[model samples]
Target: MSGGDGQPRDGSGADQPQPGRSEAEESRRGAAYGFTAYAVWGLFPLYFAALKPAGAWEILSHRILWTLLLCLVVLGLRRDLVWLRDLARRPRLAGGVTAAALLIGVNWVVYVAAVLNDHTTEAALGYFLNPIVTVALGVLVLRERLRPLQWVAVAIGALAGVYLSVAAGSVPVIALTLAFSFGGYGLVKKKVGVSLTAMQSLSAETLVLGPIAVVMLAVLTVRGDTTFTTDGAWHMTLLVLAGVATATPLLLFAAAARRVPLVTIGLLQFITPVLQLLCGVLLLHEHMSTARWTGFAIVWLALVVLTVDTLRHRTGLARARAAELADITP
Candidate 1:
């Protein structure tokens, strides 16, 4: 066995050397991938922000149409068209995919409303709380065991959400919409299985929505209320960019999600909300009351606990991976 410095190491004691470094490198690479994912997700506010005074439906239509077009182009580039073709052959799977597509469409429209209505901060909070919600849902729905600390973190986040809702004088519809929709989306994607490439799956999902999106765009154009004119060039450009922006990060996220552990991904999910919160306050100059700040602090604390637990979980997984690798070596 060799150390990072290349000195001969004691037999079976090699783990102290390469294993730590290997895991660290893996984590670093994984973080880079994960960061790329969050960064893309984080920057989404700016993308949606640019879609403009166009109502949520119009924005959604452009998103669906361009996203489908981009996904098709991407599938062709990757030569994964066969997977898509095969998907069309299975009626049940196609139906499920179609249902998932509608769910995502609803999620997208809700997100746009949040952005347009100056609820980006609430949207951030929603995603911020989503990881914990996902963890709790996993326990309830999938019969997964949660570490005690994880349970506490999830509880803390849930309480913070409730507090925030009351503080806001009503249910924070935008936050709830973002949270449940995304949480539900994640669950559905899991049911969809990893048999398909991320691109293929997203393409199929969007393809189901494509027809409706096309009809909406056409109707808007016919009524002269559409943002499809050459005078709307910048908006149109942003519209198409939405598809590229949407697909690229999702593809990056899929790459990272496969290479990293769920805990790692869960922990990394915090980045997007953090960025969005900053963008909301800094760029958009949105007001956050003291109660809102307090709620955010509570959520942040929960995330910290969740992150620590994930790190511990990842350490155990890393050790198991090293042991498995040693067993397989001649």
Candidate 2:
């Protein structure tokens, strides 16, 4: 039967559309996908560490080339080339995709270098700062208004950054670079919207950078510095599998972004840094000084404030939505 509001109702007259319930379910699913993506990303140190005997540059080239090849194969199999036609017609979006490709390229190279150089802890710190950077970008670039608690969180994060820089007697360049590059990439992705599927987006990004990767690999081969052939079959296999490793979490992340709010995505991102921190301290046996620990503690405090505010805000919105629904239902 149909209710007065034109919505379908069950025997008890409860509305069947259940917008609130469906939205909550989608949010929950997005959170799950985001968590899984970050968890995989957190374990990246181990994977990169295993790709040794290959320098950062060589590894990056292989990663780009292989990932591009993989994306193309998948797209071809799916017979999903129509998006390319659409993308070609939209110069603005194409430009955004190019910018995203460059930003991610920087992030990937820096990350690979950090792992190879035993800077995993610093890389973890970068991710820990990512949410703060993301929020700052929203304020500065998107011109979004922030609540008081958000302002407080941003202030605390800045303090933490300053303290870390002073204690180290230098700016945390790797951390800052990773945080900003990824933050910018995220912002561009958000602006681009989710009209494209995850696979399509990946394919577009890789295609943009595909030429550079190809040239780099060719140069490395001519110089006889390439490891794909010099390394044993096991090493070669690991390098090839890099395509799958790179694409999987990114695809999940894109899916999560499509389904969830940016705040929810930010909250879930803590998982990646926490896991990376553990990997650094326990697995890689990286040194963590008292000063570094203190800085991280301050960052944690900021994150706590941000997370609490987000939860409360979400709860308030949910309750208001429920009340509005109740008022409309007769």
Q: Which candidate is the best by TM-score?
A: 2
Candidate 1 residue-wise lDDT at 242? 69
Question: Where does the lowest 10-residue lDDT sum fall in candidate 1?
Answer: 1-10
Instruction: Provide the TM-score for each candidate, comma-separated.
Output: 0.84, 0.88
lDDT, each prediction: 0.72, 0.79
Models, CA RMSD each: 8.9, 8.7
The count of residue-pair clashes in candidate 2 stands at 0
lDDT of 2 by residue, 60-80 (tens): 888888888888887787687
Could you tell me the lDDT of residue 198 within candidate 1? 63
Whole-structure CA lDDT of model 2: 0.79
Give the poorly placed runs of model 1, Cα more than 4 Å off. Answer: 1-30, 258-263, 319-330
What's the distance in Å from true for residue 145, model 2? Answer: 0.7
